[model samples]
Each structure stands twice: as C-alpha cells, then as structure tokens.
Target chain A: MFWRKLLNIDSKIIYVVVGLALLLPVIKPVGMPVSISEEYTRRFYNYLTDIPKDAVVFFDLSFRETGEAELGSSVLPAFELLQKRGVKIVCGGQWQQAPFFMQSRLEKKAEEIGSVYGVDWVNIGYKPGGTATWRAMMEDFWKGAAGVDCNETKFDELPLMDRVRKLDKETFAAIVIWQAGTPGSGTWMQYAPDIPLLAVYMGGIGGNARYLRSGQVQAMIGGMQQAAEFEIITDCLGDATGLLDAQSLAVLVVIAFIVLGNISWIMVKRQDSLERSS
Target chain B: MNMDPLIMLEAVGTIAVLSYVWKENAAYRFFEFTAIGLVAAHSIVQTWNNYLKPTVRDRMIGDGEWYLLIPAAIGLLYYTRVMDKKFSWLARYPISISIGYSIGYSLAYSPRPFLKEFRNNFASFGHVNDYIFLLVWLLVVFYFIFTLMKKTKKTLRVTGAITRCLIMIYMGVLFGTSILGKFSRLLGRYQFLLRDWLRLI
Candidate 1:
C-alpha cells in the first residue's frame, strides 16, 4: 500500500512526532540505573593521577566556549587531575576566542592549584598560523609562535617559554585537546605528534560526540557523560550531575521510539502476512 | 534592565535554535546567520588585534622591514581573481603553497604513531579484552572492502553480525551524547531567559 497516500496524514504531524520525542523525556525519565564502565574510570583517574609534578602538559582549546556541553564535562576531569598532580601547563587555543574562553576557567582552576599564570602555566593565545604553524610548533616549538603570551605579553618575558624555546625532543606528558568537531581530535593528532592526544569537546547537539568514543581515540570524556563521571569521581556534583537523570531519561525515550518503530513495522508485516494467508 | 542583555539573548537564541525540529524556516535561518556572522566578525577582529596589528603591522612599520611585504604581496594575489584572466593564475601559487604545506606538515606527524597503533592492533591476537574488539575491527574492515568475495551465507552472516553489533553500540552512544548536548544548549537559553530577561531565576 502507498501508506502516506492511503492514510492522508497531514504534514503538521511530522512536527508533533519530533516535539513529543524530545519533550516526553523531559517530563518523565525511564529511571534506569547507569553502571560506570570500569576501564574508562580507571584509565581516566589513573592516567591523570599518574603524571608527576612539573611534567609539561599541552592543553589545546580547539573549540570555543559555547561548546561547553560536549567539552565542559571532559575537560573538567582532566583539569582536576592536572591541578591535583601539579602538572605544568603550556596552553594554546586553536580558536580565536580561546584566550578569553580559557582565561575564565583557568582563573578559578589556577586558584585551586595554587598555580601562577606566567610561572606555572602560560597561554600562547590563538594560533591563526593554522597547520603550518602547528607543524612549526612540533619542530621549533615557537617558530609560528615566538613571542606574545595569551595575555599579550612578550614570550621572552614569560617563564613557560624558557622550556618551550628549547623544542629539541621536548615532549609533553600529554596533550589535552578540546575539540567541538572539524579540525578537532583528528586534526591535533596529525598536526602535533609530540605527545599523547586527549580528545575533549563541547559535544555537538546530536551524534557527533560518539565519533570520538570509538577506539580511534585513546580515551574520551564522553561529553556530558564524561562531565558527570568527573563529578562522580571527584565526589563533587555540579550542574552536570544535577541534570544527569534528565539526560539519561532523554536517551531512554529515544530507545523507546526505536522499539516502537520496530513494533509498528512488525505489526504491519504480520497484518500483510494474514491477508496473504486468507 | 533587570538582568544582563547577554543572558536574555542566550535564552532567546537557544529556543530559536531548537525550533528547527518543527521545520527549518525563517526563525532558524535568522539564528543560524547570526551565529555565522558573529563568529566571522569575532575571528576577523581577533586576528587583527592579536596577530596582524600587534606583530605584523608593528614589525613592518617599526624597522621598515620590507621583507614582511612578501607574504602581503602573495596574499594580494588572491584578489587577482576579480581583475583579469591572466592575473587569475597568480592565485594558484598561494593555493599550491597551502596544499604543499598541509601535506608536508601532515607527513611529519602521521606516519609513526599510526604505524605503532597498527602494530599494537596486530600484536594483540588472543588477549581477552582486545580479542573480540580486534576481530570486530577486522570483520568491519573486510565487510567494507568492496572487492572482497563472499562465497556463502555464512560469510554474509558474519559480516552482518559484526556490522550490527558495531551499529548498535554506535547508536546507543550517539543517542545519549547528542540528547545531553542539545539539552545543555537549551539550558543555556533557559538560564538567559529566566535569569537575564525575566529576573525570575
């Protein structure tokens, strides 16, 4: 049968279906208990706590601030790990707004760690130099970025630049890359191979974050799940955990739809089979 | 006046974005365009303030460093596209340099780690944690290879099973992540509306 033609459904029905799919979960959660994957937690916490003090950590803010949904969760745990371990951070932003975006968080984070900006950590600011600049950063570490801190101070004056200036075989403990898709985790791996790349992002509103979760990445914060995990691990629940049930419920609703869709298809198939038998 | 305009803007902007589920029309288009425009403007302003004005312009004018003119001259070649047919070919130099640089840069980093990763996968044959994953990866690779020969239903079933398993895992993660992501953006808007606009939060 020509289903749409036979049924004569209104076009407005499409909107209703989508609206309900999203809204139903907001109203009522499936109340499913989520079990934390051990490997992820173990690795996430262990990978972080294992780093030694004064170990150079490269932090790349690949995405802008609005990306907090995806990246906000992932970056927190890594940041917590660094703060606790006293890792020396050499930070840079792939995005233009990175300095301003990162500055706000670091202001609080630096306070927590008793770390100073120019001494313990430094922001190299936006590198519009693109991949060419990134490659130079690998070879020279400062060819594309010789001068200027994130605060726009001369690089020679900054303490962090002392080590970075000597780029020969200098390796960071790991690189924290906050990517919101496109020129993201994949780009960092290709551009700078000096250290292990940790993928972070403010998740795209839909399916994009999952692309990082696959084994292609060594480990991931897993968007809000990652953020929630951090809160659980830290024993400090924030806005991320406050909304966890709501987020979990939303997934359950989508799964329900998939099940409903299959059931609908089977009913139609069974009815067709009955007609043929008759 | 009750709260900051930025907060109200966030709320209004968030709902405007989500309105796309009903149907993509003018409201969504307005928000979309606004976002693109804002990002472009921000990039330009930042580039000017951070790199061009401070470094390039400062160095160029300070010592009368004429050598800095080389990149500027090459960058100008991009505009030659609007001038003449003969001048259009000048653009190719910059385009070629971009392609050349990207490849040169990528080759410097990609080869070794990927080789190590490949070795890691190959080295793990019988380990419990990695064995199933390794097999699944191989099966997917085989299924995706277009020229592969499939002699029997058994071969097809194996590919189908692996593919199905991978897809199910993919969907579960995708659904969970995307939903939360959307909600966060929405919450950002609600925070704006209630806190900034209405002063009700």
Candidate 2:
C-alpha cells in the first residue's frame, strides 16, 4: 500500500520539493565547488587567453531571451577577457532578440573593463538573413551588416569596423558563439569552416561532443555548469557561480524522485506478480 | 523589497507564469498571452527598423537603387498566400526561389564539413576512447541495415541488442542535458525573484 501510494504521489508535491530545492540555495548559498572540465571549459579558456592583442573576434549572440540564463552567463566573462586582452569584437546574432538582451550587457562590461566603444567593440546587431547573411559577411562585412551598427551607426565611423572588412581568418582571429538552437554554430562550421569556432551551448553537449572530437569546433562550453566554471577560471564570478548550489540541490531532488519512482514501481510489480500467481 | 516598477512588473509576471505549475488560472493566461504578443510585436518592429528601413533609406532611396524593388516585389508576393485564394499560387514564385537558393547554397558548402565528420570517425585510433567511439559508431550504423537485419535476424540479434543499448544510453545523456538546461533557466528566474525583485539574497 505504501509503495502504491508512493507510486501515485501527487506531481504537485514533487514540484514544490524541486521549487524549494532551487529556492533555498538562493536564500543561503552553499557555494558548492564546481570543477572545470579540461576538455571543454579549459580549452575554451585557453583559446580566449591565447588570442593575440588587438586582433578582431566575431561574437554571435544567437540565443533568445529564454536561453539567456544559460548561454548568456558566458557572454559577459568572454567580453571581459577579450576586452582586457585588447582584442576587438564585432557582435551580431542569428536570433532577433539577441541584440536587445546582449548589446547592453556587452556595453556595460566594456565600460567596466575600460574598453572604448567602436574601437574596442562594435555590435552590428541582429541581421535577419541566416546563412546567406553570414556568407555575405565573409566576403564583405560592412555590406553584409547593411553598413551599420546596432544603433544604426554607420560601420565607416567605427574604427574597429575599419579593421574588420570581412569575417575571414585574416580579419577575425576566431568566432565565439553563444548558441541555443538551430542556425547557430553549425551554420558557422558549414559556411566559415576556415575560422576557428568556439561555442557555448545552452545544452546538448552530448550531441556536439563529436564536433569537438572531430576538430570542427575548436572548443566548447556547455550549459550553466561550464558557465560557472568559466567564471571561476576568468575570475569574473557572476550569477552562474552564485546559483550552482541551487542547481546541485535541484538535480539531487530530481535524482531522488527518479530513484523513489523506480523502487516503488518494482515493489508494486513484485506484489502484483505474487497475487496473480496465488 | 526592490519596489522598482520594472522589477515589480517582472516579479508579477514571473509569479503569474509560475503559478500555472500549481493550477491554470487567469493570471497565467493573461501573462502568457502578454508574453506572446510582446515577442511578436518586438519581432515585427525589429525587422522593420533593422532590415527594411535601412534598405529603403540607404539602398533604395539614398543610393537610387530602384532595382531593389524587383526583389522586394517578389518577396511581397508571399503575402498573397493569405490575402486571396485566387492568386495564392503566386506565393510559389518566392517559395521556389528561396528553396532553390538554399539548396544550391547548401550543396556548395555543406559537403566538406559532413565529409570531414565522416573521415574523423576513422581518422583516430590513438586512444581507448577513440576506439570505443569508432566501435559504437559502427554498431549504430550497422543497426540501421534494415534489409540485412531482416534476412539474418538470429545472427544479428546480439549486435542489435548492443546497438539498442548504446542508443538508449546516448538518448539518456541527451535527455539529462535537456533537463539541466531547463533547471538552469528555472534557476535564473529564481535568482531574479530573490536578488533583483525581493532583494532577499
């Protein structure tokens, strides 16, 4: 009877438990240690660190507001590192909402790091065309970006844009994308295979593991865990680090529920088998 | 309490949206529709401001590139699909062009990376992990040999079982990552409520 009741427990109870698990850590953070993965996180860090000073890098903010929490965590730290290194950045996105969320954040980070606008970084904003747009940028950056920044500031006015005439290897040292879904890093890998591609995926790291192994993607940072790992490495601790405790607790609660569910099912199945035999 | 109007509005929206997890209610419905409407409205405004406006101001008018109108007119034909049934077939012109262009572009560029992925599966045998990856890849590929499997079901039963297990494990990992993604988003909302809205943290 207990097993059957456990099996049929109200889903609302689980929701509340998980909610508490997530909430408690915010109220009092446990500061759970997050170990950085050498393969993904460290590789990503190393590539960013090794970028030569004054070189240009293209950042694709190809995630919507829904994806901001996971993928967005990596953006500020990446911007800080690149800006500190004196690397120039030209930002664009595949998603329409990308510039709205990310442009301000990038601008603020740049200010905090003492990086000048237009010279240090330029947000070309969200271009509507997908792969075709990216392909155009490869040949002629300004023309592809419709000759303006996110604010409709002409590319000619930005010193950074002057140096970044195109999106090829000679112009961009690398391309870093905060990716959520389709028309993302895959588009870059397919169209601009020559440029080294670094990705911060919101999830589906398993699916992308092959791309990393194959050397198609130079490095990758997966979800919020790696985003926290990135913050730890870069020493730009932010929301992701603070929220790890909640994440850990929520994961534990979920695992416990799964285990309880399976055990209850097995017990109930055994009881049913005995009754049937009798 | 933060009490900032923007933060207050956000808190209300967040609570309203989350309230649905307990039970569907008016607050949830109102906020849900508001979110959808806001996003749709933002998309249209952005498209106009970013792409259409710039092209018109700079390229079409400023530069006197009236030739741009030809493509613009072709694109406008897409609206005919909904405006009138008699001329709904006109949408096919733009559709075919887009499809043909995409196919051509894909054919031109997509093969190299795919071929590279295929080659890499066989390129490395230096480590135990590499060997395992190759073996698993071969097994998964072998599982899809439908005709051979039908002909020799008994002979391939063990292979099929192993392949199925590997696929299941792969799927499990994918599902786990997807859940992690969801939890991360949930954590973000929690952080916003505690830190930004309530100032509890």
Candidate 3:
C-alpha cells in the first residue's frame, strides 16, 4: 500500500520539492566546489588566451532570450577576457533577440574595461536571412550586413568594421558562437570551414562531441555548468557562479525523486506479480 | 524588494507563465498569447527597421541599385499563399527557388566537411577507443541494413542487440543533456524570481 501510494504521488508534490531545492540555495548559497573540465571549459579558455592581441574576432550571438542565462554567462567572461587581450570584437546574430540581450551586456562590459565603441567593438546586429546571409558574409561582410551597424551607423564609420571587410580567415582571428540550436556553429562549420570555430552550446554538448573530436570545432563550452566553470577560470564571477548551487541542488532533488519513483514502481509491480502467481 | 517597473513587469510575466505548470488559468493564457504576439511583432519591426528599411533607403534609392527589387519581388511572392486559392501556387516559385538554391549550396559546400568527418572515423586505429568507435559504428550500420538483417536474423541477433544497446545509451545521453538544458533555463527563472524580483538573494 505504501509503495502504491508512493508510486501514485501527485506530480505537484515533486514540483514543490524541486522548486524548494532550487530556491533554498539561491536564498542561502552552498558555494559547492565546481571542478572545471579540461576538455570543454579549459580548452575554451586556452583558445581565447592564445588569440593574438588586437586581432578581430567575430561573436555570433545565435540564441534567444530563453538561452541568455546559460549562454550569456559564458559570453560575459569571454568578452572581458578578449577585451583584456585587446582583441577587437564584431558582434552579430542568427537569432533575432540575440543582439537585444548581448549588445547591452557587451556595452556594459566595454564601459567597465574602458573600451571604445566602433573602434573596439561593433554590433552589426541580426539580419533576417539565414545560411544565405552567412554565405554572403563569407563573400563580402559589409554587403551581407546591409552596410549598417545595429544603430544604423554605416560600417564605413566604425574603425573595427573597416578591418572586417569579409568573414574569412584573413580578416577575423576566430568565430565564437553562443549557440542554442541550428543555424549556429554548424552553419559556420559548413559555410566558413576555413575560419576557426569555437562554440558555447546551451546544451546537447554530447551531440556535438563528434565535431570537437573531429577537429571541426576548435573548442566548446557546454551548457551552464561549463559557463560557471568559465566564470571561475576567467576570474569574472557573475550570475552563473551564483546560480550553480541552486542548479546542483535542483538536479539532486530531481535524481532523488527519479530513484524513489522507480523503486516504488518496482515494488508495486513485484507485489502484483506475486499475488497473480499465487 | 526591487521596485523597477521593467523588472516588475518581467516578474509578473514569469509568474503568469510558470503558473501554467500548476494549473491552466486566465493569467497563463493571457501571458502566453502576449509573448507570442510580442515576439511576432518584434520580428516584423526588427526586419523592417534593420533590414528592409536600410536596403530600400541606401541600396535601392541612394545607391541606385533598382535591380535589387527583382529579388525583393520574388521574396514577396511568398505572401501569395495567404491571398486566394487560384494564386496560392505563386508561392511555389519562391519556395522552389529557395529549395533549389539550398540544395545546390549544400552540394557545393557540405560534402568536404562530411567527407572529413567520415574519413576521420576511419583514420585512427591505434587506440582502444578508436577500435571501440569503429566496431560500434560498423555494428550500428550493419543493424540498419534491413534486408541483410532479415536474411541473417539468427546470425546477427547478438550484433543487433549490442547495436540497439549502444544506440539506446547514445539516446539516453542525449536526453540527459536535454534535461540539463531545461534545468539551466529553470534555474535562470529562479535566479530572476529571487534576485531580480523578490530581492531575496
């Protein structure tokens, strides 16, 4: 009866427990030690560190607002690191709302680091076209971007833009994409294979392991855990690090629920089978 | 408590959206529709202000690139799908062109990378991991050969079972990662609710 009752527990009860697990840590952080992975986060940092100072790098903010927390955390520290290295950044997006979140964050980080706009960084923002747009960018950057920055300022006006005439190896040092889904790093890997591609995926890092192993992707940071690890390594601790405790607790609660549910299910099944056999 | 209007509005919207998980209600429905409407409207405005407006202003008018209208007209043909039954086929022009161009483009560029990936699978045989990869790859491929499997069902039963297990493991890993992604997003909302809205953190 107890096993049957446990098996039949209301989903809302699980939800409440999970919710508390998430909330408690945020209210009072556990500051659980986060061990950084050499394969994902460290490789990502090493690649950024190795980027030659004052070289241009393209940042593809190819995620929606929903992905901001995970991908955006990675972007902040990456921006800081690149800025510290004196690398020029030119930002754009495949996802429409990508720039909406990223531009302000970049601007804020730039201000803190005393970096100038147009000269140091330029947001070309998002264009509606997808792969064709990327293909056009490979052929001619300014033309593909419709000759305007996010604010409708001409690319000719931005010093950084002058150097980024095309999105090829000669022009940009590397392409770092904060990817949520398709029309992302894969698009770059397919279209502009010549340029080095670094990816920060919101999730599904396992799916992309093949690309990294194949050397199609130079480096990758997978999901929020890696994002938090990145923050620690870069020494630019932010929301991801703060939220890690909550994330860990919530995951634990979920696993516990899964185990309990499975045990209850098995017990009920065994009891029913024994009765039927009799 | 954080009293910022924007943050307050976000909090309300977030709560409304999350409320659906508990029970379907008017607040959830209203907010859900609002989100859809807002995103659609934003997409339209962004496309106009960022892309179409500038192209028309600078390229077509200022730069005297009137020939650009030819492509624009073709793109507009997509809207014909909503017009009338008689002219719905007009949308097919743009659709065909897009599909044809994509296929041509993929054929031109995608093969090299795919070939590289395929070659890499067979490139290394030194490591134990490499042997495992190769064995699993072959087994999975052999399992999918429907006619061959049917012909030698008894002989290949063990191979098929092993391949199925490997595939299931792969799927489980994929599903696990997907769940982690959702959890991260949920944590993001929790962060917002605590730190941004309630200021509890």
Candidate 4:
C-alpha cells in the first residue's frame, strides 16, 4: 500500500516543489563559491593596463538574446577595469540588442569610476557588413560610421576623433570583443591586422578547446561555469553569482534523484521475479 | 513600479521562462515561441544586412555586374520545393558550394591541431601523474577493442565491466551538471521578477 501510494502522487507536486526551491533562492541569493579563470586575467586585461591614458579602446558587445547569462558577468569586470583607468572608450555592437543592454552596464560602471563621455568615451552604433565593417574601421572609423554616435550625434563631431581624423592613429590602444558565433574571431583577425585585439566567446560557437589553442582568440570565458568563476574572483560583484549558487545546488539534487529512481526500479523488478518463481 | 515600461516587460518575460519549473503550461510555451520567432526574424534581417545589401545590392544594380544575379537565382531555389521538382535541384548548388568551401577551409586549418591532440594523449610525459592517466587512457581504448570480437573471454569481461561502470559515472555527472545549469537560468528569471520588477524584497 505504501509503494502504491508513492507511485500515485501527481507529478505537478514535484514540479512545484522543485520550482519553488530553485526560485526562492534566486530572489534571495545565498552567495556561493566561484572559480574564476587565470586565462581571462592574462589574456584580456594584462595587456590592457599598459595603454596610455586617452588611448582609444573599443569594447564590442556580443550578446544578442540567448547568450546574455554566459557573456554578461564575464565582461563586467573588464568594463570596470577600463572605466577606472580613465582611458578613452569607443563602444559598438556586433549583436542587435547588445549595444542597448551594454549602454546601461557601462553607464552604471562609469558613474562608479567617474569616466567622462564625449571627452572620455563614445558609442558608435551598429553597421552592416561584418568583415567589411572591420576593414572600414581599420582604414577609416568615420566612413562606415559616418553621422553615427552612441547618441546619434555625428561621429565626426566627437572630440575623441578630433586629432585622429584619418582613423590611422598609431597610438590607438586595443579592441576587446565578445563573440557569439557569426562574424566571430576569424573576421576581425583577417581584416583588422593590429592594434592589440582581445576576444571572449560565450557560446558553443567556440567549436572546441582545440580551436581556442590555435591562437585565433587571445582569451575565452564560456558557459555558466566560467561566468560563476568570474563572479567569485571579483567577489560576487555582479548579479550573476546568484545563479551560480542555485545551479550547483540544482545539479546535486538532480543526481540524487536519478540514483534513487534507478535503485527503486531495480528493487521492484527483483520482487516481481521472485514472486513468479515461488 | 519605479522605472521604464520596457524594463518591467523584460523582467516579466524572464519570469515567464522560469514558470516552466512549476508546470508545463501556456506561459512557458508563449515565451519559447516568442524567443524562437524573434531569433528567426533577426537572423533573416542580419543575413540581409551583412551579406545581401553590401555585396549583392551595390554590385548588382549600382555597378551593373550581372554576375550577382547567378547567386541570387541559386538563393531563390529554396522556394522551389513547395511548387516544383526541377527547380529543387538548385538547393544542391549552395549545399555543394558550402561543403566544398568548408572542406577547403578545414583542411588548411585542422592538421596541426589534430596532430597535437593525438600526440598529447599517446606520448608519455614520464611523470607519475602522466603515467597514471596514460594507463587509464590505453585501457579504455583497448576495452572498446573487445567489441570487435564475436566471442568474449573472462579477461575481456572484467575490463568491459569496468569501462561500462566508468561510462555510467560519467553520464551521471553530465546529467547532474546539465540540470544544475538549467536551474541557474530559472533562478535568474525568478530573481528578475521578485527583486527587480515586483520589488517585494
């Protein structure tokens, strides 16, 4: 009778229990351990500190819709690092919603770090032609980006572009890009030859670890695990750390369920076989 | 309650995705379909912006190349399956080209990396840790070799059982990891609702 009752409870109850358990913690996060990688430190930021003040460093926002969780937290610290240093920034988009989303993230950090805009930074909106745009930016930042700014003010009017009218400034610093597949690491490497580029890919488009080791990308932070690590290293600085703790706990619970299920099923089968023999 | 209308909607949208953990119902499906539709529409627009407008448009009409029409024609072949059979053959044209180009690209790219991985696993480093890993690796590889034989031996059975157990453990870990990963997203969605939008906290 007990076994029969156990089998009879509606699956709905299970769903509600699991859902609430996962959801409640997220609303009220209990901070957990995060294991941030050394690669992100060395590859993306180590080369960045040397760039002189007011050197143009472009931040490429690569999130569209699906890749936000994996991409967002990983890039947060890097943005904070750039803002604190008082370096000039040129921001743009490779994904549609990315610019709008990152505008807020950058603005919040800028307030904290006291980085000035138009004087200290600017955002150039999206453009067509992935490879073509990279080539245009390399040859001329204004030709493809003409009459565009982070605010729709003409690109030429920006003070940051004043001395560097030709887009061929040798002193320009670096381009840090986040990638989610198309127009990925290959395109920029092919067209934009130098100016010290760094990239992070947050999705399965990385192909595999083997491709990453080929020097195509300077650095990479992938999946939720890496993002959690970044959050831990930065002392749970961003909101993403909440998700990490929830995920680790969820995994543990699921594993326990699967083992128990298999054991129960095996026991039932054994009892049935014994009864038939008797 | 505090800020922009769109931010509230985005927060609601996130909670809708998380609602699935409670039940398989209409809200989750709506969000899933909306996400899919938006992505598909966005991809089409992006392809036009990135590929069609700059390359084919400027060259086709502005420069009067006439050669751009060929690719344009091949691209239109996708609609042929609905109405006609003969035109369906055009689909092969792009597939063949894609396969050919990818083959060429990968051939040039894959050799060194492939050799490096192959050598890394097989070649012993002479360290204690390295030897232990190498021994397990070779044993696993050889255990798979037993599948080739029509008959089984006592020795093969032991190794086969060990390999099977290892595989099960690996699968269990992977399943657990996936569940945890998904729950993380659900948690984010729930947080957006409770703290950011509702401000109940």
- Pick the TM-score winner: 2
Residues A76-132, model 4: lDDT tens digits: 676666666777777777766676667777777777777776777777756655544
Note the residue pairs that clash in candidate 3: none
Residue A121 shift from truth in candidate 3, angstroms: 1.2
Per-residue lDDT of A65 in model 4:
46
Order the candidates by lDDT, highest first.
2, 3, 1, 4
Task: Identify the superior model by TM-score, candidate 3 or candidate 4.
Answer: 3
lDDT of each: 0.63, 0.87, 0.86, 0.62
Name the lDDT value of residue A61 in candidate 1: 79
lDDT of 4 by residue, B19-84 (tens): 675667887899899988987897787556544664555556767888878877776767666667
| lDDT for residue B93 in candidate 1, whole number 0-100 | 82
Backbone N/Cα/C clashes per model: 8, 0, 0, 3
- The Cα error of candidate 2 at residue B20, in Å, is 1.7
Name the docking class for model 2.
medium
Per model, how much of the real contact set is kept? 0.23, 0.58, 0.53, 0.21
lDDT of 1: 0.63
- Give candidates' CA RMSD values in order: 4.6, 1.8, 1.9, 5.9
Worst 10 residues of 4 chain A by lDDT: A203-212
